[model samples]
Target: MLIFSKAKLVFLSMPKTGTTAYETALSPFASQYVCDPPELKHAPVYRYNRFFRPMLEKFVSPDIETLAVVREPIDWLGSWYRYRHRPFLAGKPTSTAGMSFDAFVQAYCKGSRPAFANVGSQVNFVKPQPNGTKVDHLFRYENQSGLLTFLEERLGIKIELARENVSPAMPLSLSPEVEEKLRRKCAEEFELWESIT
Candidate 1:
């Protein structure tokens, strides 16, 4: 997560949404940067509300605009599947080695997901808090230019991002049956992604 005090913006890092690249390029300009410890780096709305909001409200500004990026649901899952397939994770319970994309997604659709498919939901990550804290600007991960434009204009700086934390490329094909099950079970993921302008 990156917080700009003067800009009054909090950039929430949604997993697999190219946030690492943003952090790399923009961290120097941010007033506060939380990049260490994956738990804090990817703190969701509820966690931010609990741990960071109060301090920001008191010390920085009470009204901070939150921003986040949501990737297309299937593509997001594919990233996770391919990421875990990296050689470093081979043989680990959380690894996707030797697993087909269809099987990985099917596991994701289960009521109790297996370790390899236990990635968190983007919808829950950006959901509005009880106090009405919500994302003020939400961007699609595919719209990198749009997000960069918004950031440049908002922060008064030229933005340059280098690709980072990319999973290895692989042909990912989900069977229709598994895709249907995923859409049915995770409708909110698609809905949230579609809602972004």
Candidate 2:
């Protein structure tokens, strides 16, 4: 997460949505950047509301707005599948080395997901809190230009992003059956992505 106090903006890092690049590019201008400890680095809306919000409101500005980027649902899951399929995770429980993309996604739709398919939901990551704390600005991962424009205009600085923490390139496909199941089971994921115009 990157907090630009002067701009009253907090960029929430939504996983697998190419947020690492933004964090890298914006860190120099940010008053605070949290990159260590994956949990804190990727703290979702609820986590932020519970932990960071109060402190930030008291010390910084109470009107801080949040920004988040969300990728298309299938592409986001594919990224996770490819990432865990890396050789470095070969022996870990979270490894997806031998699994097909279909199997990985099927596992993700299960009531109790296996570690390899346990990538958290993007919708949940930015869901609105009961008190209405939520992402004030949301962008699609594919629309880099739109996001960059917003950031540059808001921060009053030129912006550039470099690819960071990218998953391996791999051909991934899901069977129609599995795709249907995923959509049915995780409708919110698709809905959230669609809602981000």
Candidate 3:
């Protein structure tokens, strides 16, 4: 997460949504850059509210607006699948080695997901808190120009992003039936991504 106190803006890092690029580009200008410890680096809305928000309310401003990016659900899952299938993760339980993209996604839709398919939901990460804390600005990962424009205007800095932590290149596709099951089981993921506009 990157916090620009002067701008009253906090950028929440959603996993696999090109946040690493943003962090790399914006960290130097941010008031606070939580880039260590994956738990804090990728802290979600609820986690921010519980830990960082109160501190900011007291020190920064009470009305700091939050920002986040969401990716199209299937592509997001595919990224995870490809990432885990990297050479380094060959022996790990989280690795997607030897698994087809369809099997990985099908496993993801299961009530109890296997370790390899346990990527968390983006919908839950950005869901509004009961106290009304939520992302003030949400951008689709597909809409990089829109997000960059907002950030540059808000921060008064020219922004440039570099690709980072990219998954391996591989042909990936899901069967129609499995895709249907994923949409049915994880409708909120699709709905939120579609709603970003």
Q: Pick the candidate with the highest lDDT.
A: 3
Error of 3 at 107 (Å): 0.6
Reference-based TM-score, model 2: 0.98
Residues 1-197, candidate 2, lDDT per residue (tens digit)? 99999999999998999989989898999999999799999999999999999999999999999999999999999999999999989989999998899999989999999889889999889989999999999999999999999999999999887899999999988999999999999999999989988
lDDT of 3 by residue, 1-197 (tens): 99999999999999999999999999999999998899999999999999999999999999899999999999999999999999889989999999899999999999999899999999999989999999999999999999999999999999878899999899998999999999999999999999988
lDDT for residue 143 in candidate 3, whole number 0-100: 95
lDDT tens readout by residue for model 1, 42-132: 9999999999999998999898888999999999999999999999999899999998999999999998999999999999999999889
Error of model 2, residue 168, in angstroms: 0.4
Candidate 2 global Cα RMSD: 0.7
Q: How many collisions between residues are there in candidate 1?
A: 0
TM-score of each: 0.98, 0.98, 0.98
* Clashing residue pairs, backbone N/CA/C < 3 A, model 1: none
